[model samples]
Target chain A: MADEVKLFRTWSSPFALRIVWALKLKGIEFETIFEDLANKSSLLLQNNPVHKKVPVLVHNGKSVCESFVILEYIDETWTNGLPLLPKDPYERAEARFWAKFSDEKLWLSARGILFGVETEQAEARLQAIQNLQYLEEQLKGRKFFAGETIGFLDLAVGWMANLLSVLEEITGYVLIEEVKFPLLWKWMQDFSDVPVINESWPSRDKLVIKFQTMRDSYLAGKI
Target chain B: MADEVKLFRTWSSPFALRIVWALKLKGIEFETIFEDLANKSSLLLQNNPVHKKVPVLVHNGKSVCESFVILEYIDETWTNGLPLLPKDPYERAEARFWAKFSDEKLWLSARGILFGVETEQAEARLQAIQNLQYLEEQLKGRKFFAGETIGFLDLAVGWMANLLSVLEEITGYVLIEEVKFPLLWKWMQDFSDVPVINESWPSRDKLVIKFQTMRDSYLAGKI
Candidate 1:
């Protein structure tokens, strides 16, 4: 294809995985440039000077950085592809609200385990689960965030479900449970069962080892 | 017009101004519903149950909450207008980067006055100025956030500039000075000078009094 699209990514990064999932769902063929986190490429640095982070998508040599923004770009560019954003403006805004909230609250909660060392830090992890009660509240009756279809908000909130168990195992605390957060528990199943998402996802066995390894290295001060 | 739009806003809110500016730029006619913060309507609560915040854009009986999300909705629905998002995906991503950063760091710094007492708040104000240094560094050779034309990022970041001066005036610490943050200061002036923005902006004098009054009320435990 003359319309060459290239993606730069580092494995074991949920932020990077967001873009990867979108690309796979869209079924867009492109070159994948797996970046060395330790020794970052000049192209990655040049393309994304502000963040200089992974999952920079380059289409025809023009780059789109930031996973959420990149997701929006890919959705906008490929008209005939699977629509990532909702068609209704209000629904789109609601999806974005959850997206922003995901960045604001959920992901940060997951990061708690990565840096949790103190008693307060460990307690903070529990408090984060309490903070995520809002998700259960939001999911009360909606089949999906945008109603009966997986959309951007679903993808975003789904990241929490994928990471929570691994995060709990690493941090030595059980947070989300089917017995407690039934709606969110069901959300985990609903999201993971999406065929496209299922195909695109790294195996849980694979992620558990990867995340656990990274967490161990980080905790041991070897990272 | 059967396809109607309504904006519920507070007089002293930067978030509200964003919607006002967007509608004015698009030449869209809509009913302005100014809500008294002291006496919020049931409709406002019903429309935005999550945050219950103003600056909600009600279009054709559908409600869109959050200013940035509203901006996106506005852009998508009304196409025969000056665009807020850059046409190019890369540029749009860059715009989003700055926009998100503005919301995170800049707003955190600007809203310092809301938290602590005087001296602490002054540094909180200073932190906002320091936050702009990174922005200044980025704008070293550029005119606007995404290059020549004012785009989405410009609107978000410019909100910081408007509020910075207001916060400074109320807190007795000037944040933006011509000599220190020249680029940001000049850019703010350039931004407000534009006919659409200039016409739509609330008067500075009015905001200064309103901010000071609000601050005093908070300190007096009247809030």
Candidate 2:
């Protein structure tokens, strides 16, 4: 039986976009079901009842939720073209660790800078910058996070290549100065140049408007 | 050279204990270096500079940090033992998902019950119980999380078998009533009855005393 793959996603969610990049990179033909996160489709809720979030991959009647989990599923199931995770056990663990760090530490701290209160934004920005420095150190002399080509860690932090600038523009937080994080700056340019990634990114102008409104709501205590 | 395996752990930590259980279940010989979390050892700090936390498995002089990441590392590297994760791609994704849910949602909410302020305990307890309900439902007819044998998800949530009761005693909030979570209650009994888990648990009396002091500090605003 041929594989039937469908992804539940929002255009602007980096988590959802990770799945898109992975699938496209692997040359997998999958259907995309864009979700209105505000009024989520029943299909999404049914597939992912636990988190009720997007980036759920429905394949051959089974659904996999969570972007990281979905990414692993794609790599393991589609075993052709590009492997998302590395082949060696140790390298695989390192990829998982950095992917996790990207989400739990880097993204969480960065999100704080985007949405945190005025008094907390400075502290959040500092922590986010520190977290970015860790990535900079990791990227020292490497072409991409996975090295030579886009892999799990590259797709994991791919959002930063585009959305980060949008965040900085809205919040006036100078997060990724080239002088401070030269390697990361280079990585951003390199990551954005990947054909699959470049083609898959949401419109930057639209993302800026969307995030600007959300940040406004967060600052005004409306959401 | 023989695989030099060493696990950095703390006896009272559920996260660390998961590694101990994984190593023992795999029948791998290893050394254990207990860390004084208050004044962490340089080895622990150096090995896991990112998190500076325990449950680091150093195999052949290379270190893997993060309990979940380490668990995967052990399963992949050792291939001989009882498989920690399922062989199927979809099932593996499910195991990863629940393991994540166990930590991010279930344990986080339960920790709030143990350490959250008095005014917030009720809400935290409610959220923890709700999270447990999800686990209970997952265990409806299965002997263990992986069906017949103890697997990744079992080890992921193995802490509740011992520590939940201690937290309940410390906070005066009953989380797992037998009537409310009968399946979970049975899983707890079955999980504790496993030989490795049964033998490896810290003394209940010591845990009670330790948590009581920690809770006192939390209540007193000292920690």
Candidate 3:
């Protein structure tokens, strides 16, 4: 039987975009079911009861939740494309490590800068910059986090290329100055230049407005 | 060159124990270098500069830092073993999701209960139990999380079998009662019964003393 791929996602989620980019990169056809996260569909609720989050990939009736997990699934299931992860065990571990680091540490630090209380923003910004420095070091002498090609780590950290800028604009906090994180700044440009990624991002204007409203809500203690 | 596997770990850490269980499960010969976490060896600091935590597996000269990442490394490098992750992409995704869920959500909830401030303990206990209920449901018909054999998810959550009880004892809050979570409770027994797992665990008495001191330090605002 031919594979039937469907993605449950919101329009603006970077997590969902990771799967979209992976599918596009792999040249796989998929149905994108845009979800209103405020009122999530029963399909998403059923597929991802634990998190009830977006970027749930349903393939051949089996559902894969979690973006990184879905990315690995997409790579494993669609072997015709350039491999997302390296074949060597050590290299694969390194990729997975950075991918996880990007999501958990770097992303969380960015979130702190975005949503933290006014008193805490300065400390949070410093933490985010420190985390960004790690990414800067990782990108040294490499085009992407995965090297030469845009691969798993690139997709994992891709949000920083665009969404982070929107966040910086909304919060008036410039965490990734070119002077501060030169390689990472270059990486942002390199990541956004990828045809699949460049073509797939949501409108920057829409994201800025969306994040600005969300940041306001966060500051008001409504979220 | 012959494969060289060395594990940097603290004897009492559940995270370190996960790597220990994985290596032993594969019947792979490895050198164990015990780290005094308070006064960590330069080898460990150099190997895992990011976290500077234990369960750093250095195979040949390359080091894999995170425990879950290390588990995958072990599975991929040692192909002769009964697979840590399932062969099917879908099953592998499911295992990864649950493994992540265990480490991030369930484990953090347990931590909140263990070290959270006095006023937060009640709420944290409820959250931990809610997370445990999710695990109970996942274990409905299965003997282990990966079915008849203990695999990735099993090792990911194996800490609950031993260390959770220590936390409960130290904090005086029982999170896992057989009547409340019969299946998860049984799965814990089954997980601990595995010879390698049973043999490798730190002394329960020592753990209680260690955790009690840690918990006191936490409540005393020293940690």
Candidate 4:
């Protein structure tokens, strides 16, 4: 493996997990370096100075930061493997839109539930419900964000598989329950069942514990 | 000019503005089709059913959504023009990194400041200042986000030129003044002065009144 790939990542980071999933799907074996968020390395800062966050893919000593960008780089650099983006120009643009949508729409829905000191818990619930409603409407007749197979949106939103539980655990609410958001519920089950994804995902229990710690710290004015 | 390119855009949207800059820089004459957000056309919905957002570039009947994705499509289709993205693989990847940096980092900063509720105004300012500090560090000695010339990053963050005044008019906070964010302040000047950008920009007075009306409407509980 002379052309080995290396990554600087964080275990609970959805961004980092997305990269891990891509690497696994491609069957590319690479070395992983996990950084403790509380005590990050100088190298991580150097690699991603603007954001200084995780999931930096260093391919052949060159670094590509940002998870989605890393995904595109991964696709472009490797010509033969499973292509994450589509071949059609419009289709590729559509994939990128959903990937962007996953963050802008879904995260707001989830984050509205997760953080906020002044907003009523009921308002957060209402916000989260509205978000899920919109998502459910979008997923009404589609198997995935794209037509058939999992594409960028799946990777973009797949973090919900791990982090949704953390929000539920903290707030004592289940936003993705089968009764309320059946499409999202069903999609999660199918997405996680993908063989590569099933094998590559980090421990759910560990992520919950980590999210709890972060929440506790935020509440205690420690973050 | 039957085969002229077409653009679906709004005045305030940075993403759409990016397409304008690219097309203008390349000396391509395009028919601008402005979309009314309040009453979106069936065509806009059909073109980008996923996001239902603007800056959708229609070339020869096919549409491309998302500014970064559209930039790529423009580069690929208009191969003979002044390149927005670099040609080399490594350099291209890095250009993408910064472009993603604009979307991932700078955008959040611009958004929170522009759209945050009144009580969250302070937090929005904090995010803006933090983002500017990060940019200063990233662009420490480098002339532009892309070393020598105005590249993708410049276009990516160019919306701040239109957005700065709107945020100021709405919140009465000046984040991009000459003394406070000198580099970024100069950046606005540098970005706006290019003949292509200067000629293609939305009238600042029109944009100010639009933001004022929008802000008044938001305060009046219409939005």
B-chain TM-scores per prediction: 0.89, 0.96, 0.96, 0.85
Rank the candidate models, highest lDDT first.
2, 3, 1, 4
Q: Which residue pairs show collisions in model 1?
A: none
Tell me the tens digit of each residue's lDDT in model 1 across A39-75: 9999889877657888888988887877788888888
lDDT of 1 at B185: 76
**After superposition, candidate 1 runs with Cα above 4 Å error:** A34-43, A109-149, A170-187, A194-196, A199-223, B35-41, B111-150, B167-186, B209-223
lDDT (Cα, tens digit) per residue for candidate 2, span B1-223:
8889999999888899999999999999999999999999999998999899998999988999999999999999999989999999998998999999989998888878878876677788888988998899889789899998999999999999989999988878888889999989999999999999999999999999999998788779954
Model 2 error, position B10 (Å): 1.2
Docking class of 2: high
Reference-based TM-score, model 1: 0.77
A1-223: candidate 3 lDDT, tens digit per residue: 8889999999999999999999999999999999999899999999898999998999988899999999999999898988999899888998899889888888888888778867687888887887787878888889888889999999998888898888878778887888888888888898888899999999999998887887788778854
Model 2, B212: alpha-carbon shift in Å?
A: 1.8
Q: Which 10-residue span in candidate 4 chain A carries the lowest summed lDDT?
A: A112-121
Residue A221 lDDT (model 3): 83
Listed models, DockQ each: 0.59, 0.95, 0.93, 0.48
True contacts kept of each: 0.91, 1.00, 1.00, 0.50
**Which lDDT value does model 1 have at B211?**
73
Better model by lDDT, 1 or 2? Answer: 2
Q: Which window of 10 residues has the lowest lDDT sum in candidate 3 chain A? A: A214-223
Best by lDDT: 2
Best by DockQ: 2
